[model samples]
Target chain A: MKTIQAVSYPVHFQDKAYKELSSLITKNGYSTIFILVDENTFEHCYPKFIPNLDSEKRIEVIEIESGEINKNIETCIGVWNAITELGGDRKSLLITLGGGVITDLGGFVASCFKRGIDFVNIPTTLLSMVDASVGGKTGVDLGVLKNQIGLFSNPEMVIVDVDFLTTVTEREIKSGMAEIIKYGVTYDIKLFKEIKKNKGLHINDLIFRSIEIKNEVVLQDPKEKNLRKILNFGHTIGHAIESFYLESEDKKNLTHGEAIAIGMVCESYISNKLLNFPETKLNEIKEVVLSIYDRINLLKEDFAGIMELLKHDKKNVNGQVNFVLLNDYENHKLDCKVTEDLIVDSMEFYNF
Target chain B: MKTIQAVSYPVHFQDKAYKELSSLITKNGYSTIFILVDENTFEHCYPKFIPNLDSEKRIEVIEIESGEINKNIETCIGVWNAITELGGDRKSLLITLGGGVITDLGGFVASCFKRGIDFVNIPTTLLSMVDASVGGKTGVDLGVLKNQIGLFSNPEMVIVDVDFLTTVTEREIKSGMAEIIKYGVTYDIKLFKEIKKNKGLHINDLIFRSIEIKNEVVLQDPKEKNLRKILNFGHTIGHAIESFYLESEDKKNLTHGEAIAIGMVCESYISNKLLNFPETKLNEIKEVVLSIYDRINLLKEDFAGIMELLKHDKKNVNGQVNFVLLNDYENHKLDCKVTEDLIVDSMEFYNF
Candidate 1:
């Protein structure tokens, strides 16, 4: 098992991660333990998860409904009230056991419960292991806006057990791959090439590389003031697209990775046009993303709606929509403002 | 104006505080400014507050109902939704201008909105100026529980203007004095003696002294691991009594200071019994508290409810209700456990 000391806590990898969790719980001497899981993880992951913990602490399970819709203030209130009613206190430990939604919502719940309590994350999904679990960013979507209510609170520990991934669907796996691809595009060209060559689903090396890149950026700028904005290369447009589809009555809910995949394609085109990014690399990015994620078609009508959503992006500062454009692999420009015409042109490139 | 650097920011005292606020706002360059106030502050204090702010920043005023009942999750949701709809973003600044309730809830809203934004506290009431604004503790009550959901995120600055306090009622002024008295009991003997000697209502020196003591304790232990628990000397029982009256059908709502004044008397009695606190000092404490806060009559039925509420105190560890008891002036014993029989005896002492 590999252990990476993150900005706030340690991220333990593989089967031995549970051992570390047990030790951490014992060391911290928590009064009680509460495990937060969604319906899917409660069924698919909790059975195996329970046996790994060897602590004699009184443990309680809080199960919320699965999916993004449940990750709101209502769910947080329910969870908080449950913990309070069940006698969970400042010394209680909340272990968030599931995907990004569970981790994000659970972390936010724990962070706010009695002015913050100690919590750990055992991320089940590939997206969470590489991204959500590493960053101390925990929050829930406000209305159609994603991550609009949250805090930068790290968990006591993060246990990344890939064994939980066996039950995850291929679509979910591919969804997580978008972020890995993003890390490669933004910080590591060799990593991009390495992932392209490796066809098998097993990519522990790739996930670790992504986390390392994120942690390095986060360490330099934890508050996303400057260097950390580079991490949002695809997320600004991706989150907007994600929110647009999420709210649309006719459209299917896009997985975070799927939406971000579309976002990467669109933003990469913008980077190519405005920042002299290689046409060949842009083509390569499109091919790789398209092979994994089905192309999301955006009509001229949809462009206005998506752009409207983009304006609400949390990354925007002082009414100016900022984008991180890449001129070359690992040579990224941060906080570059682009016009609406260029954004529409980028969407045209994605549609093509 | 006396300026004290707190754990994360500065606490600016008196008229010069607003100038500091203007400079801080100008220097930071926030996208927008949203001022959070209760009805009382809006009617009584904001007019005086507006003239002090010499900035051209676009400011919006969000007013909630004046009182503790409005400090809940429902109100937080309303405020958050309003901010989202109003196009408030990461760069926006939430300037909380009111008593404890406004500062507490507003600070909490700013902390969680968009995973945290910059906030400043311009405390109108004396209670907030001395205690609430300096601690970096932002939260709202849950059900009957006080400050059950919150975050330990400090504001960018705290501007304590005594000018706003001129409009406050005498009852409200006394409420703020409870915390000032608490600071003297727990940490500073000389300050306590000085307060007892001074008959005047003008307590600028006392307020400054109370904040300095709190800031010193908070700096030593930011997370309340050990030393900071001393700050909760009166708060444990105080919060329960406050919650009890707030929820009681027949009882009138007690101000935070009123509730805590009663708590200090009971806990001080417990200290005398358990830790050999000086009998003369205990009498002095009782006399001073009773003179300021009207004696709250707790019937036999109320004891069971108050004790039940006491068990749920966030200061508890492994189900043991812990407290900070003083045996001598400035000599505090933290995490001391008392039996139910002794707690009842302490209440009996107050009843006597």
Candidate 2:
């Protein structure tokens, strides 16, 4: 029973609230346990993780292959099979241990296992702990789409320990940082400034602030009915760039965070052009980000291709490109609708 | 832009509402569109699916290998790559086109595309339309672990057209029917009785009733915070039984519904033993289910295994073995917190 108190969750970041988990279990006195993990974490994390679990003889560990390709029906067959094989009764508890992949997948698994199950998320990566862990949103990806498949099932408990980030690579750290930065830009200007220095980004501070900002947004709108959509500041272009990279042979060359960093910058330019974000601030944003991220050059041909890609973005409400455009740093978000012309114009900023 | 209305939603069904899809799109003015399908649906149903589709110049179709095994991070990566290669952007609209597997996977994909995306579900099978499509629960399973990896995100709209079920096999129908039957038994007694007296179940009538009953329960508790647990009556023991079949080569294989039928009977006996369900009603319950589902003999050696398996049931509230017991039909659901002795005693009823 590990309990982690996120910074924004503020009071304390304890995993599973040790006393709470034990007391709850004691009160309930349930029979079984289910552990959900992906291929990478099961092999790597479970060796040490299994011994510490209190599931006793009733434990079953279900593992899926790691990556976004397996996040569909076929993988569900594996889950359906595992649940069947494990003889998971309704009384069983599923504990998810992995990165965003595990937390998202585990929550979905628990939600649909007998129409829903009790699940706890033990995120083991910077991205998952900060971004995926707090939000109740869970799901897998579909082809040419991201998170097209999912639900809003909150976990019984979220165990976000920085210890998990220790195993992550520099690239993974950056991917998680993209969202952390988004939080600062969308809502917390001060935090954004702090992270911009890249000074307090020593894993612990980033984790706390990122988690804190997310918790605040999530608390306001558990379901992204409104304000939460503001969090998509950099994600709009980030996702498309990610898709662009993923589709090409250059897939290996790009990371999730790197793409999002590029997205934030592009969208920032769009924000400046469409939503009247001041040029001074826009340049400041560009300067701050360009200093950290290698600027990506786009071919003229790729401009149309990229614009075409942006059309597939899910944020388009009803068909209009609904962007979480920035206004006065952290003061406002304009859900602006951009056309291809404007979109193409925005890409020029990234070329520099 | 196709819509289906099997459950008497406030809106009109397929063709009539397709205009609305276009209207919705036209009104909002979308940028891009992406469709999600599994291997089976892609090959079999896609040709028929595309003509009626709300076409976009920048649209792309993504396909994942069909089957539950493929639903996971790896598959999500495949989707991410497809979306990337296809150049999907934040303005993208994802349409899920398949059975439960496709919708579940696709929904998750859209949700995490760039943290989250807006998508719609076109559930092709009865099981999915009735179960998966409505709930917005999306995810893939871990190897030997059912639905171990996932996220929760609802579609912008749910389109359930029974026309798709035409391609379903009898076995598939039964699998879907298992859930229909559960809804009847647990939530609506009238529906249960309606399903019971069937010289053979009428396709439309039975399916309609099942969906209606399910809709009622779902509407009451959109999220399974409470009240929805009754739906797990048969699933509690049933899931473990299903897993037993999957794990043991010698055990007779059963479809999801068939296993639930067995679980209902055994638990009916348990309900009688623990909660004073009348012997006559218990007998009626068993008779109805046994007649519907063929019997499987349980060896004494399997008792310990089954008992051990109960702990794996993810529905256990805390650590307690929670049972959804019925006092009489669907009128009353008694949440029974049973001890090890009661669970073991109940297993005896399933011994042939």
Candidate 3:
């Protein structure tokens, strides 16, 4: 088993991850154990997942409807009531098993349940294992706003098992890859070059390296005050575009990574124009992102909606949109203000 | 002006509080300022409060219906949306100006808003000033459960002004006194005797002493793992009684302190029976509680209802109800399990 001690908790990888989970459960001496899972993971992963653990304590299961839309206060109420109905107390242990939605919402619920109880994460998706699971950020969306309500609470531990990725769709795999690409673009040029060179990389190695890159950055700035803003390389505009598509009636729904893939391209164009980023490097980034994610075209009206959404971004300050742009590979500049006209031009550049 | 530095934040007393708040707001440089007020506070306290502080930042107000019943997810949603619509961001400042209901819910909404924003609490009621404002506990109830969902996040500062107590009703004042009496019983026998002797006590001094006792206990145990359980002396049965009345159609709603007064009497009797607590001391405690609070008759059916609610107490473990019993003056025994029949007897003792 490969173990990475994160800023606040340990992330365990490989076949022996469940063994560590069982030991943690026994050593902690929790009164009861409750598992929170979404509908999809409950069906595909629960049986294979729970049998690996060894514990005599009573284990309860709570399942919420699968998807991002279900990650709301209503679902939190249902899960909270389930724990209450099952007699969960302050000393009870909550093990969240599933992807980002499950881990994020479940983590928030656990953090707020009876002024918080002990919780561990067993992230079943690649996106969650590398990005959501490693970072201590836990929250849910409000209306069309993504991750609008939450807290900075770390789980007691995070268990990452690549075996669960076998059930994930290819689109989901590509979506998770976008975040991995982000870590490379922002911090490690060598890793970015390696990813671009090898299309069929080992999933475990990819997950570990991506998480390592994020962990190093997070350890330096846990609160996203300054240095941590670098982690938002594509997130600022990406999240706005994601929210616009999520709420739009006519547009096709974009996965988190798909929107971010487009966001990276637009942001790269802005970097090249304003930050003196090399045109060749920007082309390389666009080629890799376009090869994995389908190109998304933004119409003139869509540009207005996306730009309006950008004003509400959490990263924005005093109603100004801020972006993290790379001047050279692994040399990132944070909190750079970009004008609406320049953003529109970048969108047109992506369209071309 | 008197100041008590808590484990996490400072509680400022009298006129200097607003000055401190102004300094904090200026130093932090928040994007915007939002004040969360209950209907009562908005009508009675907001006019006086705004004149004291000096800041050029934009200040917005969000008002919710006053009282404990309104402290639920529905109110949180309303306040959260109001902040969102008014352009609240990570750098926004939330100033909670009301009683326990406002501070508890507002603190929670702020803690979860954009994964938390800076908040300052200006407690306007006596109960809130002494008990609610001192503790970092922030949350709202789920159905009949009191504080079922919450977090242990501290506000940046707490402002306690005794002038606001003038608007508080006598019944409300007595409700706040119950927690003060609990602090005396659990830690300071000297303060207990002082309260017993003086009918017309200094309100500010009393508030300060009660808060000091609580802060001392909390500093020792921030997360109620062990020593902090002593603070739950009257809360176990008190919360159950409070919840019972909250849900009952026929029973008149009991204020928190009123319920706790009855709870203290019942638990004192149990202490006398099981732990050899001084019978005369128990009688004196009962006399003081009954003199300030009107004695209410509980039927056999009400006892069953209260007992059922006790099973759902957050302090309980593995279906066993735990109590904090007084073995002697200022000596507490925590996590002591009592039989169901003994609990009924304690209720009978209170009835007599």
Candidate 4:
């Protein structure tokens, strides 16, 4: 029920968020209100979201297909054309009610529509609530390159309604848990210990804490110049792996969290080898991550492809692929470079 | 050539621009430097542009086709892909070298690439040097709607070299004169009087004064909320006519300045009827505009389409077509509404 203040906007929780959203709509007097949703949100959340907003304004729903594959410029063009066709204009407000793909893509659509329009994020999935909610990073992937095209543009507000979580699948919940686990490894030892307890995770408490931790880091470095790189601890390898799986003939798609869970395990091994990361902590991290996420079998032929994908990582400076490694729980080393052979060795370690 | 200090960056003129650019390249340590140009700039300006930049950084030229018709999302996707394929990254520098279309499109491309990269505008054509060089308005048009999608994002600096003017056609120079003329009508009577003198016009003084007037207006109203609306004095009707000619089956493709010349004539009539603008001054404006530009005959059938296009103007607040009109030289009124019949009469007046 608490509202967390971001750099420019506020993140509200529970039923109170709807009240805030209603007031915001009245205050702004937007010409049109557009809610951007994927198939999932349109089915479940849309039914709930409409009744809550107390406004007589013309509300229109713009829907895209549900998946990471659809998060590209083609879909953006569709939404833009749709908004224009639907009589949406400069004073229109876009409300994104779905997962990361919806929020990220929707936020970007608003940012470019008529130079920029007001938008609010009502994140339905846990991945979006804690991860996408705080960061103003709005963009879609260029090909399989994760978030290759996007800019940091803040939303009017972020509303996190827990009721939407009940509609999500168990796998979807675990996908979000990856980012929370990331917060544990890179920022908070207590969060890591809580997950390590092996009991049912306190979803609400975890989501609130993860948002707080992520917001703190973003406040200091919104553009991801230095300190923010720590949030990318597992992402360098995770994104490459995600892209590799998506493009492979097998088409073994991985949820973002699932890929990142693997990335954390592999990066932990590299951290132990290069940094003075204790052997025990490395083993503990791998065990904890593996326990939460099913181990993915990476094809021996896949290593070269994943490495190739790493070259296109957004974090890379000049020609070198940079990684965020941890020396211990909550102790991060930024911009560390490793050889392709070492990365291969880490994957081999994961297979073992 | 004294550099004009804009809101954030300096506007360097002539030979001194190259010196400032070389020093900037040395200072930023950009990973790569990419220059965006249309075919015209690539052929005429690129040869001269490359020799001036004194850096060993990897320089690449990405060329789009010439003209306003190509200023759409398709061209942007191509440039975005080209930048990605050419190994452009976050630290890359994009130097847009051409007229308004090239700078506007290139600036938008850089602003969205990896969230944003540093870009410099090197306006080669007279139109760009005075108009596009100062305003950070970057975007591509959607369909026939002019500037339907874009954001206000600044470039690192703008290099205005008058030497490139020699490469431009008389018509192209005249297209730029429209914006300078708009500035004259909305902001400074001296500029209007100077253009009225008809002594073949002074290029350097006009360019400098145009930039100063535009920069001063932009500093106060960067987002075009109030005072900045004056800049759109003729754009509301000018853009509709421009789009009308482009989409017409005959494809008359009136040069931007020519279409705007008609717009100023029509809108000035509206100003005279509604705002009590002196009819004699309006006739003087018409004469001055007609002297430099040839009139495009608009079919009676075309008037309805141009009117329909007015509804899509970006300046519309709540379905009301907003126009910026002048009561007198340097005395402007914002958000003026005119009836359809009066608009028709105004066009008839132009025909007369």
Ranking by DockQ: 3, 1, 4, 2
- For residues A189-271, could you state the per-residue lDDT of candidate 2 as single tens digits? 77778877765456767777777778777788776767888877878877887777677774354667777888788888888
TM-score of candidate 2 against the unseen true structure = 0.63
Model 3 chain A worst lDDT run, 10 consecutive residues: A12-21
TM-score of each: 0.98, 0.63, 0.99, 0.98
- Interface root-mean-square deviation (Å) of every model: 1.1, 6.7, 0.7, 1.0
What TM-score does the predicted chain A of each candidate obtain versus native chain A?
0.98, 0.90, 0.98, 0.98
Residue pair clashes in candidate 4: A115-B150
Leading candidate by DockQ: 3
Candidate 3 has an lDDT of 0.89
Per-residue lDDT for A1-352 in model 1, tens only?
5688889798888777877888888898998999999888999899989998899999999999999988899899999999998999898999999999999999999999999999999988889988898779999987777888999999998888888889799999888888899888888888788778776745777777778888888889998888788789888889988888888999998999998998899899999988989999999999998888888888788889998998988888777899999989888898899999998898888889
**lDDT, candidate 3, B220-306, per-residue tens:** 888887778887888888899998998999889999999999999989999999999999999999999988999988788888889
The residue ranges of model 3 lying beyond 4 angstroms of the native Cα positions read: none
Predicted model 2 interface RMSD: 6.7
Q: Model 1 off-target regions past 4 Å?
A: none
Please give fnat for model 4. 0.73
Residue B18 accuracy (lDDT) in model 2:
59
Ten contiguous residues with the weakest lDDT in model 4 chain B: B290-299
